[model samples]
Structure formats: C-alpha cells, structure tokens
Target: MTTATAIVAGHGLALRRSLPLPNPPGRPTTVSLSARSLPHARRRTIVPVSPSPRRPCRCRSISSESSTAASAASDTVEEDAEPAETYDEDEDEELDPQAEVCYLDPDADPEAIREWELDFCSRPILDARGKKVWELVVCDATLSLQFTRYFPNNAINSVTLRDALASVPEALGVPLPDRVRFFRSQMQTIITRACGELGLKAVPSRRCVSLLLWLDERYEAVYSRHPGFQAGTRPLLALDNPFPTTLPENLVGDKWAFVQLPFSAVREEVESLERRYAFGAGLDLDLLGFELDDSTLVPGVAVESSRAKPLAAWMNGLEICAMEVDTGRGSLILSAGVSTRYIYSGYEKTPAATQEAEAWEAAKKACGGLHFLAIQENLNSDGCVGFWLLLDLPPPPV
Candidate 1:
C-alpha cells in the first residue's frame, strides 16, 4: 500500500506527493504547520505560463470598484495581463491588515490561520430562569482557536452577536478573520448584518466542516451531561435545501464532460500552472484527516463556454458546496451557498451522458466524495478560468 501527502499551495491549489506507506491508510500522522521543515517535503519551482494571446472576454474584478464604466475599462486593460499576477495584486491589498498584525507577533503566521466558523443558535439546554439558552461557538478552520459563550434566547440579536464577535481577536489572541462562515440559513439575516457592521464578509455556507464537527462533539460530551439538557430535542440547525434551479441562460455552458484525474496527475499537471480563480483551501484532504493512495481517482466535471471568465467569476462568488447527479431530474445539480442549488447540465435519457454520470458517481464515491469542477474555454485549453476542489459531505443528522 502507498499513501500520498497533500499540501495546499499558492492560492489554494491542491498539491500532493506519493510516499511509501508508513502508517495504515486513513490514519495520517499528525503534521504541524508550525514545524520549520519536514524531511519529506520538497520544493517545486513554478514555471509561469504567459497569458494566451487569444484571451476570452474578461470578467470584471470582483474586488474592484462598483462603477460599471470603471470596471469595463479595467477589464479591457487586464485582458492582456497574466491572471495570476492580477489576482496576487488584489490579494495583497486584502491581507495588509493581517500582515501588519503578524509583524507585531512573530509567532503568528497569517497564512496558517484559516477563516473563522461561527454558530449562533438555540441549544438543547435551558437557563435557571426557564428561558431557553442560546450559544455562540467560534472556531478557526484548523480547530486550534475556539470561543464559546451562552446567552438567553431573548438576547439573540445583532447587537449581542456583534459585541461577541468584536471580542474574538482579544479573547483568542488572533487577528480578525477576513470572512466568517456559518452553516445555518435561518440565522442569515442577523449574521450577515452583524458581520457587515464589523467589516467582515459573512458567508452562508455548508462548508463549515470544522465547526460542525466541533458542535457534534460538544453535543455528546458536554451538552448531554448537563442537568438542564433536554432529552431528544431536535437538531439546532437544519437547512431546507430547495430543488435545483436552472442556470442563468447566459451563463450556461455550451459543452460539458465528465473527467477524472489521478492524485499523481493533479500534483504534476494541475499544480504546475496557476489558476485565475481557485478555491480549495477549506477542502484539504490531509487537514480533513484523510490519507489515500497516490493512484486514487479524483472525479470531476469540465464545462466549456465562450464566456468562461464571467462564468468562473459568478461561481467564485458562491460558496461552492457540492455537485451531484440528480437521477430523478435527469440533471447534474450543483449545491452552493447555504441551500442554493443550480442545474449544471441535463442528461435526460441520453445513454452516453447517463453512463458518464454513473461512472463519475462511482469514481467519486471511491474517493470518499472528493471531486472538482473546472471551467475552461475548451477541452484542449491549457489554462482554466476557475477550478474548485469540492467535497460532498453527508447531510447533518436529524
């Protein structure tokens, strides 16, 4: 048996290296990011690829000013610039605050600190006054920093949430997160407003894997042992995922294909080139505690469109949750941001499409629901407008 070590590099590209199996598969040796160096870790030089001369229509930068005229003019000039260079420049502006804070504390590495995951909802326990107790739980993606506080149900509002969030930096001795992710849709309005007031991007996403795991642990180990704990209470947070909606007419892909890449190829071919828009930092298999063989197949879907840049930008704004084959609807469904869903493509009764979908589902299952989605101008294109490594996690227990 052989295992692979996964590393998330430059702007969330997933990189891996095959290693001789030391421990049993699925039991990964704990590797700390704080370590100065690992004997097994090797550096790979990134050979920059020049932007294609025949560039597709560019998408307006999402981080830029809102004026349409200004955005259009900027997009025209950016068409000739390297996508990676443009992204790096924008990112530096966003990280200036974090960088400044890290300078004051040499021990704190801003790159190693993941976004904060927060949950503010009613708990299964009650206070002495007979009022239901609500709790706020905050934890970083790595689960290294945590803050928990309880309040009466009546006190659950934006003001209370805001004050609690404001204290997180000092309480946990970490810089404010660029974004805060919460899984509950019912609390979206309050959470969004609270984060907005504090200049934090509040994302409604099911990608709060670390926070969910912590909540489950506390439910069984801490909540259940409390005297005020209510027995057999319903789950605190449940999302009513709606049916898949059709993709916007203009954004629909002209061609699509089911694809697969081995772990070795992902590290070699995919990681070598920088992507225009990439989002996979939260889906690291090693951080999520999975160790698989280098030959493991990573199933995915490729979409091609003339408006590849715009399509990629639109998808990047959404918290990409998962992609699945909806056999009943005969369509490929993409789940994103809280309970939002989109029909990626329709297979109908086509034999070839159905078979390909089946193969993709099988391969994805074999790899523990790990897959990706790539947006490119065409199948033969060397560069991708967007690439996302997504995980299809099981629904929360009722």
Candidate 2:
C-alpha cells in the first residue's frame, strides 16, 4: 500500500493518500496532490503556538437531564418570611481540624474555580486491620487544588464522603464547586449520592485529565511507600466495556470522510465556527504537554448529517472519549463516557481499510493521541454543529 503526503495550501491541511481513503462510496474526493486544483479553498491564520492555553471543551448549549430535574426541584422551595439573625462565634473553631489538604497550585485564584474532579475508591494498600484502604482524591480542572483523604474499607460510605467534600472549602478557603466530575462509572451510586446531599451536580465523565495524572503520580510516590501497599495490585479495577452498539438509525450520517488539518487551522476554524449549537474539548495542547508544530496534521472524521443539530445535541450529553479501529471486528468504534461503545461505521475487509486505519492511528500517535469528530450539514458546509477534539490518553499506571 503506497501512501503519499500532499499539502493543502490555503486551507492549512496535509492530506495523506492511502489508496481508496476512508470516504463514502461515490463522493467526490476532498484530498488531492495539488492544492491549487481543489475546489472552494479558504485562507486561515497560522499560529506557531497558541498564546494562552485553550479552555477545556464543555457542552454548554443545553443542560443535562439531571441538572434540569435539580433546577425544577429547587423552584418549589419557599423563602423564609423573616430573616434569621447572625450570631457571633469564635474564629478559631476549625471545621474538620484533622483534614489535611494539598494545593497543586497554591496561587490559583479561588474565583476561577468552577468544577472539580473526584475519585473515591479503594487503593492498593491495606490498613492494620488487614482491610483494603479507600481514598478520596479531589482536584480542580487546572490542577490548582488537590485534597486527598484515606479511610478504612468498612467506613467508606456516602455520609463519610460528604463530610470529606464539605471540609475541602473550609480547608482551602475556596468556594464549593458547582459541579464534580468522576470517571469511574462503577462508583456512580455512592459518588452521586454524596454530591447530591450537598447540592453539587455530579457528572460521570472521562474528561478528568488532571485527576488521572495526579493518580499516576500518587501511585508511584505515595501509595508505593506505604508499608501495607500490595504489590502488583491494579490502581483501578478493570470494568468490562459494553459491546459496540450501532448508532441510532435517525442519527446516522449520509456520508463521512477521513480527513486531516493543520493544528493551527483546526484551532482557528473550530473556534470561529458559526452555528446554532457547537460543543467540544477546546485546544489544550499546552496542558497535555504536547509540542507539535503548527503544520502538524491531525486526523479527524467529518460526518455529513442532515439531522446534524439533533445528533450533535444527543452527543453533547455523552462524554465523547475516543475512536479506535477494531481490526478483528472490521469496525470503527467510538468509545464514549465510561463504558459505552458504539460502532460508528464498518470498514471493508480489504487492504485499503487496513492501510487507512494504520495511517490514521499513526497520525494520532504523532499528535499525542489527539483526533476530532466533526458533524456538519454537508461536505460544503462552512461550519459544524459539533466539533469534538478528543484525546485518547493512556490509562493511568495501574
């Protein structure tokens, strides 16, 4: 399988030609060896590097179902007829005096704090009672504030977890976060209950980048040093992912193509997208420590959907995780949230698909496992309703 790389001049993209590239049957080819010969080319700015780090992408156009229910419930509450009087108290009285909090960035502004990533689960260490030790780790998105506490397995519960969460604000002088995100779907029941008791919105998502990185560091530096640390124990229990399911019949696209764009072009165009609804992880290469050049090609899938708005809205509710080419199944798999897997499309059993998949994977690896999913009205659409920049980071060291 011969492959050739061609530059798309004004558009700021590099096309890698693998024979019979991943495109729907009978669609006009979007990639060409000569950029000047391509139809409808557009110009874009090329930035060597972004000045300030891009913010993490969030679905902001619509609130989740859980949040809507919470909002409705709050509306029924009545205000007090009389205002309560304040009482003077000693300033020295400490809240959870025993709690020890660690700040990743001591100078991080409290006003900037909004969301928190939390992990409450059993560690690889045992207590004197020979029971597994449980831990509660919390951090903001910016790696500014981190709080960790350990508990015995027997004492781990929603009540204990709530108290630990409450103590964070008192210990760090930061306000309670509006929302808390966790990656473990298995711990959903307890984590959700604990957050609910304190009126904090709980989100189950795979976007806990900072927390995962912190866990990796702690596994090597803190947990390993414990006298009761169990060697060879996995940091996180492995959960079986559901088999890949098909996308909804109504949401399937009319056509799709595998494409690549320069990092600068992606940043410029995605940010300037003119659409009624758009959501995705913004460019945050700096946070991930990726050092690719502006011209580096980033692979992505472009879907032309007549029902683009509805499809994008539905996907916004999910934690869009990663994409993979499953050679054994001969399918393109989209992994979302914790364990939900979807068969985005299937590939022919021919060598072209294998070659294209290899090239896509190679490009993703070169760009630090970063790729994108774009949903637009058509191939000629100026903007997409949804453009997710996803990172397929490796699981933290077990």
Candidate 3:
C-alpha cells in the first residue's frame, strides 16, 4: 500500500513531501523576507545662518561685499576639497554562505530525466579493465524508503516524519521541514551504514532519487513504502566487473549493498570540477590526473583546449596539486585544493596589468564586491597565504 505524499517546489526553495503519507498537496509555498518601512518625512537641507546679513546692507553695499566674499570663498574651496568624510552604508552587506540555492520547478516533468554529473574527491571503484572509476551519487526517496523499511526500528519512525512536517507552521509554509535535515540526522545513519559497508557515501541518495522521480513521473504511492525496493531499476553500467560486496545475495544480504553509476559521466564530472576549481578558485588539481578532459574551446573564452588535447592540459593550465573527494552509489565529487602559483600567475604578469588589477580590486571592495587581491608573499611552496575581501551588508529589513 502506497502512502500519500506531495512534492513541493518554490522559487528559491524546493521541499520533499513534508507530510509522510496520506497528506494532500497544498499551494505553492514561498520563503518570506521581512520588509522595513522608512519614515514618511522628507529630508530637509541645513542652511548656514548669515549673521543677520550685517544689519541688512543696501544693494550697492552688498555688491561691493560680493567681490570680497568671492575671494574668501575661493580660499575656503581649497581647504574643503580635501576629501569629504562621507559614510558608506553599503559596507556592511554580507555574503550568503549557503551552499546550494534550490527551488522546485513544479513544471518539472518526471518523464524528462535530466542528466547531471556527481563529483568525488577520489575514485569510488575499479572497472574490469583495472581502470579506476568515479561514481555519481544522488539522493533517492525510494532508496530512503528502502533503508526506512530495511531497518524500521532504528530509523526515524513514520510517525515522526509526519509530525516534523506538520510542525511547519502556516506562517512559514513549506510542505516539510528541510528534507536535508531528515537525511543528516535520521536517514543518514541507515544509509551510511548500508552503503558504507559497500564503501559508498550516502549523501547522493537525494540527488539520485530526485533525478529518478523527476524523470519517471511516478506518484508518491510508488515510493511511500519500502516493500517494492528490491525491484528498483538497475542503472546503465559500463564496467566489466560488479561492485564489491554490493549485490544482494540470499546467503548474506546484510554483508553487501549496491549502487549504480555511469563511468563516462563520472569522468566528465571530475574533469569539469578540475577545470572550474583550477581556473576560478586556484584549487590544486594534482590528484585529479585520472580524470579525462572533454573541453573544447569556444570563441570568447581565451583559454582553449582541443578535443584531442590530453586531459592533463586543463590541469597544467592551473597548477593544481590535489583534491578532496567523496563518492557513493550514484555520485562522485571532487574538491580541488588549487595551487597558489597558477592562481596568482596568469599568462601575463605585466606591471601595468598588475596595478590596474589592484586598483580595480580596491574599487570593488569599496563597492561591496568580491575582491581577489593578490598576496605579495612567495607562493611557490604549498602553504600560500591569501585573503578574501567580502561585502558586509545588514540583514534584510524585518
């Protein structure tokens, strides 16, 4: 029997079914921002009092004084022009440190399975050819249900799922509380234990499951319970060997678990991560030598890589030394620690260009923008020092 649940998506936020089962899909919800109202009075300019105009001088006498006053004003102008001390209210704007900004595209057609790459800091598997392979992991609601039923006693009870969701007060409406929270606390334990035995991380369950639900267009009833989990469709595989101790076997089902990943896609994701972190963030890419590059140069993007160029060219362009990785059933993620030498040392290091960049950085900082300032210290060694000049903005008016 399938329990009822609704998938809710919003402009900046998307939520999984808040109500576990037997709940109706409600209206589209929005995260509200409080607005502050300013006072209605108009600002008045302060004028200097003119000493009662020296007993109201006549027009002829005032004309004579005007010439003398003009000379005095000229003398004061030089002193006043010494840079006014104006306050910058914009200096306090803050950066949103949040990782992902998400929204549900209700128009999301489950029938259309969009493909994305999962990155990893390290290889998750080895193919039959003895080649190291990456994995792209995703969050699977069905998988969650599988683990939910697989170990119902230890997992978050279905009743708690319902209550937590129901706790979302009408004022701050969303179908469920943050689904990620559920995964981190309740679902994560079961998944990690299950997949960890198979040497995979559990975070990809969301991305993987969301991908399937969106592409398949199956209803909540299809996934509300855990019984049908054994029949989950197998993902396309290009590897010659089966995953280690992951396949379900009657002899020892508890000893093993399995996750599906596409090898080519994994390679692509790792390559992309390498290029992105290396070029933009100065991430070291040494450990990512295994990932093959698939980038081709477009006209406007000056740095060009040919289809035939070795993948290492991308890494060479940016002096990356290593990467941090997380891998799982259907996902592979790679976080590169970029080399400082490449980040600071672009193709050209002319004096004029350096000065211009410094000035631009200063201006950007003043305007509350991202300032990529260069450190004068030597960056040849591994430990290079750098700092970020970020904007500091006040919280949105409540």
Candidate 4:
C-alpha cells in the first residue's frame, strides 16, 4: 500500500490517502518510474509552520491505475476527518437547561390550604448564583428595648422572670419610662389596676403574694390593651425586670453570697408544673420571698405623693405563702397576711350590725374576679402579705 500526507492548516486537520494493497501483510515491491510518469511526476513539498496549530494528512498509492481510485477514497476520508465538537462536564452543569424546568406537581394543594404553615418568611433569601453563589442568611437580630438578666447581686440570671415581665404589658403600659424605677412603678400600678378589673377574690395574706397577683392581673390586662406585643408601633406596657434580684454587695457586706434563681431552673420548674398541675398552671412561689428593707430605697412617687406607701409598706412587710385556684379564672395569686385599719372603708357606716355583715359579705363576693388585690396593712416586718392573680383556664373535662 502507498500513502500520502498533508496538513490542513485552515481546518486544523490531517488528511490521509491510501492506495490499493496487493495482499494482507505482504512486503512491498519497488518498480521503476516510466518515462511518461517522470514528465508528470510531482515532487513532495513540506509546508512552512503556521502560527495556528494544525494536524498533518497522509496519502498512499499502490499502482498507477489504482492512483485514481485512491484519490477517490482520499476524498471520502477527508470528509471523515472533520473535527468533532467537544463536550465539557463543567460547562454542561452550569448551563443545565433542566434547572429552569420545575417538576412540582400541578395537583398539589395550595400552601394556605395546609393545616399548618411552614414559613421561611423570617428566614433570609438567596440573592444571586454564580461560581460562588450569594446567599442571605439571618444574622443577629436586635431587640428594640435594652434589657439584662434580672437580679444583679444574685446567682440566678432570672431570664424566666424577666421574660414574664416582658409578657405583662397591661400591668406595665405606654409612654416608655427612662429609668427602671419609674418602670417598676408603672408596672405595679398596671398590676393593681388589672387585679381591680378582674375582681380577684382576696384572702387575708401577705402582701408579697398580693403583689404577684397584681403582676398576674396586669399581664392579663395587656391582652385586652395592646392585644399582641407588636413592634414598629409603641410597645404596650410590658414588664421586664432585667436587674438581678439579689442583694447587692453593698447589702451583703463584702460577701458574694446570694440566693438566686437560674432562668433554666425556673423554666424547668414551670414546665414541670404545667405538666403536673394542668396547662397554664400557676407558678409556685413558695420558695420565693420579698424583703424590702429600710435601706432599700423606693423610687418613683412618694406614697402620699404617689399613693404607693400603702402598697410599698404592704410589700416590704409581707412574704409570699401559696397560690390558690378559684373558679372561671383560677386564683393563681393567694396568700394571708396581717390586716391594718384604713381611714376610708369605701362603705357607709351603719348602726345595724347585720347591715355591716351583709355589706362585708357583698364586698367579698364583689372581689371574686377583680384581677388586682391591694390593701393597706399595718402589718409587722415579718407579717405575711397575700396577693393573687386570676388565671383563665380551659374548662375542666366533663
């Protein structure tokens, strides 16, 4: 067999031409060029190197008669030598046409029709796609108001109590105060008002429990006042005592000793109570005590000035005993304490002893659902002061 080669620079390809073979694996026999062939014979030439890369082509001839047949075969071979288009996995992945073709079921139910909505509304969304696609993930979120763990001087970081405060707005309400003390007063008033509105029945108990009741009433009141603790608008009065409730070093005398409540521990206790007692069960405050000493400076208004003296004195002298459950709204707040006489009874003096008894009975019934329970007590420092809040529970199973 005879072969010829040529480089196709323009097409970057090699062409090959083959001549007819005598037999398979046979040795070639050389023959002299004829005088006629010498006149027409063309010398092979090497092409100059081109800047562009190219492939060389080859040609072969077996005999003069078969040369034409070889040329014809070469032409067919040239067509076969065309460059094939290259395929790349990386490029294909990037230009995946199927990506835009969503395969979601058309028969699927609408998102709103589901029993529960799984929302990514609060989650961050993607922005762009490329070699390094951009994504927006939720980072740190900020609270509009500043706060800290309650009880600075104690061991317990009181997150649960602080959160409880945040939850109570009716007892806490509007016109944000600049100072914490003022905030406390506003909260206390809110609590008292709620107790009054709820008509919580009162027992003679320590004032501390009553204070707690006030706190609970205020919490319930906010539900009616602002509804939800919505933002972007003014926040309804919400209770939040970030300050630690521990005795300060100044009070404890260089001693770091403090009786504190850890937020986690409180949470566990609350959860356990909820399971054991019932959903929305009243929190146990038996271990908790409030001792307002003379050194403990009260802020906000003067009692005769702020009408807080009776409330303050009651608070300082009392210790929380226990919470009781009543009807409709559970009596979450209940305790007994020393009683003091007040100048005003908000009742008329009657000569008939029976009339006074009847009035007292009516007064007791009237106080049944009043949420806030406040009283003036000439109670001793160690005397118990009872307070109570109304908890509206789900109706008991029949």
Candidate 5:
C-alpha cells in the first residue's frame, strides 16, 4: 500500500481531489475538517505530526489514533526531559482512540458541515456503500478537556518522584513560574495538534488551563471555588477541594496532595467513547487523591460506577481511605475505574449467544458505549447463557 502526506496548513482544509484515502488506521475518514493548531499552539509550537495516508486526495479527514501522542512527543526536546528513561507499560501501550481525540462523525463532507459547527457535537453514523463497509475508531481530543489521563496524575514518574520535584523545570535552572508556563503552553500545543491530526477540533484554552494548573502545584489558586472535598479544610464557603478520606494516614506529611480531576470538563468526553470492536472510557477516568510527602501518584485516574462500590470523597466529615499506602516507598494513590461490558456474540445452539451483529449491538448497548471497564460472559452450569455487566475501575491510582 502507498501513502501520502496531507498537511493541514490553515483554519480550513480544502479537498485536492474527490477520492477516498486510506483510513488513518483507527478513526473515521468520512468527513473533512480544517487542520489548525490551538491559538497557543503557535507559541511553544509543539505541533503533533500525524501519519499520512497513501491515497491521492486533498485535505480529507483521517484517523491516526496512535499518532497523536507520539507525533507530539516526536517534535519535542523539552518534553523528553521530564519523563524518566522508562515509560509505564500501560501508558506505553497504544491509547484508546476516542479516549484521546475528539471526533465528529457526520456522514457528510466539509461542504455540508461548516467549520465553527465542529465545536459542538459529532457522532458515529453508518452509511452503506455498494460492496464495502468499515467503522470509525476513537482518537485523543485536541485539548484533552475530555481526555482523562493528564489529570489525577496517578501515573507517577517514578524517576521524577524519587527526588521530589526533579521533574519541575526549576530543577534545571529555569525560574519555577516561567518553566510551568512553558510546559503549560506546550501542553496546549500538543492537545491542539493531536486533535487536528486526527480530524478533530482543537481543545479549548480554558480547559487546557484547568488541566495545566491542576497538574502544576504552582497554580492551585485556580481550583474551583466549590470542589466539594468532603473533609476539605476551607469552611464550606471556600472554593478549593477538601481533604479526601481515601488517602492513607500519617505515613506522614503536612501537604495535602491528591490527583486533581477536571471532571466537569471531561465527563462529556468520557460519555462520548466508541463501543464497537471494544474501547474503554477516558482510559479509566482519572480519579483524584492526596499526595504524600514521600510517595507520589502515577498520573492516571480510577473511574467507579454501579458494579464497583463507590467511595465517597468524605465519609461523614472523616477522610475515607482508599486502602493501599505503601508501594515500595515511592508511590502515591491515583486510581480510576472502568465498567466494562462484553456481549456474547457467537453461534452454537448448544449455547445461547446473542448472535453476531445482534450480539455486538447488544453488547454496545449493554456496555456504556464509550465508558466501560469490566466485562464477562459465561454459560451457566445448567447450560443457560449468562452475561455479566460489570463496572471496572482501575485500583485507585497506585
């Protein structure tokens, strides 16, 4: 198969040819979207470069789910410094597409769907061709406002945490404030470029700021006025987060450090995940927690739903503990949960299965579409078919 590059150079992309291009590997290529970086993306200029397809075509929309992060990381030297020599195996794995880029699935082209309109909603639509059929895949959002991994910093940089703040730019001679600003700016660029490459809209700056400030301790002042932390110190009148009960006790430190989650912004994103062929939510929604003086969170979240017992942020004024607190000395709790749903799609009268396409659709409906984590299918001892619909949230970020 041959491939070609279709760089998106401006606010809107113009079709060079009216022909189908190879799908961007994982997402929908049904429509054409303008390819522009976020406004701030122009500053630090950490544009994410997407993989090009081999077909001859203009700037048609394409899907390159795996390309988002790699593309962004590929162009940077600064981002290279913070992460340790090794990346967590989980994060190292190819991320869920919808969990990464925002997509608008209209069965039309740019001529039908206007640009600004792309700002609002997009859905998965099915159209039939004479003899071909394919489904769209998920990609990371440009702003990641809907993306969950960045928040809840549960996926800790073991190397950076080992030395407390070593990842901070200040450790390298740059002023604390300036360095934080620079990183934030770059994050904005990554989000925008990530979205652009995948044929998604840019992540808004406001959402970007929330993620940036939440990740960088230097900007906690921007936290919402009513985080509703159950035991948070600021009298009920204060806006910041309260102390969470899930944290382990006095292993010891005065600082309250739990992963931060911009749920208000990401909930919608999580709800928009794709279910066909199997995908999970915001990669297990980022759950928030407190930071220990010596221990650190790995930078991820635990999403909890019905099947799993949900822990309240505060249990009657007392902090609720998430249980584990000792992970070889250098770990913080950042757990997200996912409720996975699997449908039995098979054929064998000896067993009752949902029957291929019907079972698949049933599974999609039974599962939370884009927000599932745990799933199971079993044939009862009596040979009766049984399906287990479960909610799987990752262990509180470890």
Candidate 6:
C-alpha cells in the first residue's frame, strides 16, 4: 500500500495519497500563460529550464527599495500595457474554484532536471555577500510583510533584481529607479491577487509549494509584454532541483525537522551536530564549502506570522536554508545535510553531467529515500563547479 502524504489545502494540512503522478495533460497554447485574470498582463516570459513539480521542466527575483521595498510605485506601465482590469470586490458571483491551482505532489519527478548553478553573483552587477531577498507570505487569508524589518538599512539593492529588470531594458521607458519602484508595486499586487485565486493560507512554509508556480507564470506574462526579452540566457523564475534526493529505496523518514534563517553562530552549532551525526553514521561526508548567500528561497518575499504571532510556532517542521551561499543564485536550495544513511551513500562522485545524474537513481533503490543527498560544488552558469552536482531528489514537502 502507498503511504499517505500530507498536503496543505482547504485552509490547513490535509492527508492525501502519495505517488509519482504527473499533471494531467492539458491543451497546448501558443502563448505561455492563459490568463484567468489581469487583462493587461503579458505572458511571453522565457523559462529556459523549468523542472515543474507535475509539469516537467516548467519552473519559478527579489530586490528592494529602502527595504528592497520601493517607496514609490511608478504609475508607468509596460509599453504594451493595457488598461488595468478592475477587480470587483463587491461582486457576488462565485470565484473560479479550479482556476490555476499549483498542486505540489512531493512524490512526482521532473524531466530535464539540471544542477542549478550559482554564477549570478560573479556578475559585476550581481556581486554581493548577503543581499536582502523577500517572498510573499500568506496567513489566515492575509499578506504578511514582517521580514521587512530585517533590512532596516535597505540602502543596498540586489544587482540581479535590477539587472533582470535591465534585461527587460526598461519598465515602460521609465528610469531604472522608477522601474524598480513599479516592479515592487506590481509584484505585491500580482501575489495578492494570486493568493485569492489559489486560496492559499497566510502561514509560514505552507505556501512554499505553490508560490513559485504563480511567480513562474507571472514571469512569462511580464516578459512577453517586454520589448527585448531574448529567448536565451537565464529566466526571471528560479527553481530548486525538483528532486533533492533520489534513491531507489522508498524510505520516508521523519517530517522535515526545520527551515528558517539562522545566525552564523547557531548555524555553526547546527553544522557541528550534523557533522558528528554523519561521521558516526559512517557516511564519511565530504567537506563541502557552505554558501553564505542571503538571497531567500523565494526572493522578494517577506514571510512571518500575523502581527500577534511569531515565527517560532512554525519555523521548525520546514526544510529551508536562508543563508546558504547558493540561495541567491537561482532558486531555492533544499539541502539534506551530507547523508542520511551510510548504505545509501554508495555512489562515488562522477564526472559528465548525464552519467552523474544516475546517482539519484542509485539512491532510490532504498525505501523512504526522502533525505538522501548528492554532492556538488559551487557553480557558475557557463560551467559546472568542481564535483558540483545537478541533483534530483524527492519533491519538497508542502
């Protein structure tokens, strides 16, 4: 019998059947996104490599004004911008229930999976140690911008965020500063509208599974409207390796232990504990360098509990890393420490992209393989880093 998995929907956590199921095939469309709303929204963004949860290879920027949160939003719209469609808050008609729901089946696999490279930092415009990143957090059916406080001194702006905008060349011929301003405004509006459409809760870690999907679609919509978004060279949306651990054996270990931003001292303490566990388990973990990149898993989002509550209630039980060096590079990085079990760590590091990918295949040979890991080095977009991996593991927990 298949083990039951928990998925967050219908307001809270709901238990559902778990299996490697692909999304039901849908009709092909000439354009990327088929809008359910936002009449003026564009939908021609480039998704170079999207390893969607159910939609193969389909996948998911952050910057700020004073807080990476721009002070003044530009009234200027995209050159091809259509008049904003009015949202009818007073409408009594029922909302579309089946509208663009991003279901993250943790048991599913992705096609065209590749190792996400961390090269954007090297770009003169993107070079940085710890830039402020943010994400949209929904709790109790409301938006939360609590994390904005972390960047009280929001003097610094993210280069990639600005450059990605620059890639568009300009937002409606507006100055770059104005473009950033509008970008923040539009992002907030877009995400707010998205939560209502998808019915996601305003809680920590719960929205992780679906937030990226919405952004990925939004990226295309905005890009299609842009004048010079080329077909090649990175996309606006970034995604974590669809499968973080792939082992032949199906071993569903404990629920995710924790996911949150930690101070350096705390991180070091955790690392020390993790190392002892790995060595004692005889996993003989390799000493890989750690990432200090502060870019969030969902850049530009500010997730926190409601004003009355704090993060302590739900910070644990989630698997996330905010300070890892690679966090800023592409999409989220889901690390499972070095290894969960010595027996599963049988595969040696291999060269050549395709061949090395087989390591995940080797791992799945065991049961409940959710926490398995393959090693990779820090990478630039053009080339793979030293022994760096293009990974495939089980889907991220909802």
TM-score of every candidate relative to the true structure: 0.67, 0.74, 0.19, 0.15, 0.17, 0.20
For model 5, residues 1-398, the per-residue Cα lDDT tens digits are 21111212111121221222222122222211111111100112112232222211111111112111111121222222121112234542433322322222222232222212011111111113221111111111221111111112222332322122222222222211111111122234443443444344442211112222222211121111112211112111111122222323211111111111122222322333342213232322222111111111011112221212211221111211121211222222222211111111111221111121122222222222211122111111111011111121111000
Residue lDDT tens for model 4, 1-398: 33322222212122343322121112122211010100111222222222111111111111111111101111221132111122234543444311211111223222321111000011011113211111111100010121111121222222323333333222223222211211122234333333334332222222222233222222222211322222232122222222112221111110000011122222233334434322122222221211112111111000111223443344433332222222222111233232221111011122222232232222222222111222112111111122222211111000
Give the C-alpha miss distance for residue 71 in model 1, angstroms.
43
Decide which is better by TM-score, 1 or 5.
Answer: 1
lDDT to native, each model? 0.58, 0.62, 0.20, 0.21, 0.20, 0.21
Higher-ranked by TM-score: 2 or 5? 2
Residue 3, candidate 6: how far off, in angstroms?
21
- Clashing residue pairs in candidate 1 are none
Q: If ranked by TM-score, best first, what sequence of candidates would result? A: 2, 1, 6, 3, 5, 4
Candidate 1 structure, TM-score to reference: 0.67
Tens digits of lDDT, candidate 2, 1-398:
32333334223345555543343233233321111111112545543332222221111111111111001011111311111111123322322323434554555788689899998888878889998888889987666677888898888788999999999998888999999998888888888999999999999887787677566556544566677877766545543367988765554676566667666566565455444336556544444444445666667777766778887877778778778768676667888877788877665556645655666666665565667887777756666778787776545443
What tens-digit string does per-residue lDDT give for candidate 1 at 269-324? 34533543443333534334334445455667777778788877787878887888
The best candidate by lDDT is 2
**Candidate number with the higher TM-score (2 or 4):** 2
Model 4 C-alpha RMSD to native: 47.1
Q: How close is candidate 2 to the true structure, as a TM-score?
A: 0.74
Of the two candidates 1 and 2, the one with more favorable TM-score, higher being better, is: 2
Model 1, C-alpha of 74: deviation from truth (Å): 49
Top TM-score model: 2
- State the displacement of the C-alpha of residue 50, model 6, in Å, after optimal TM-score superposition: 22
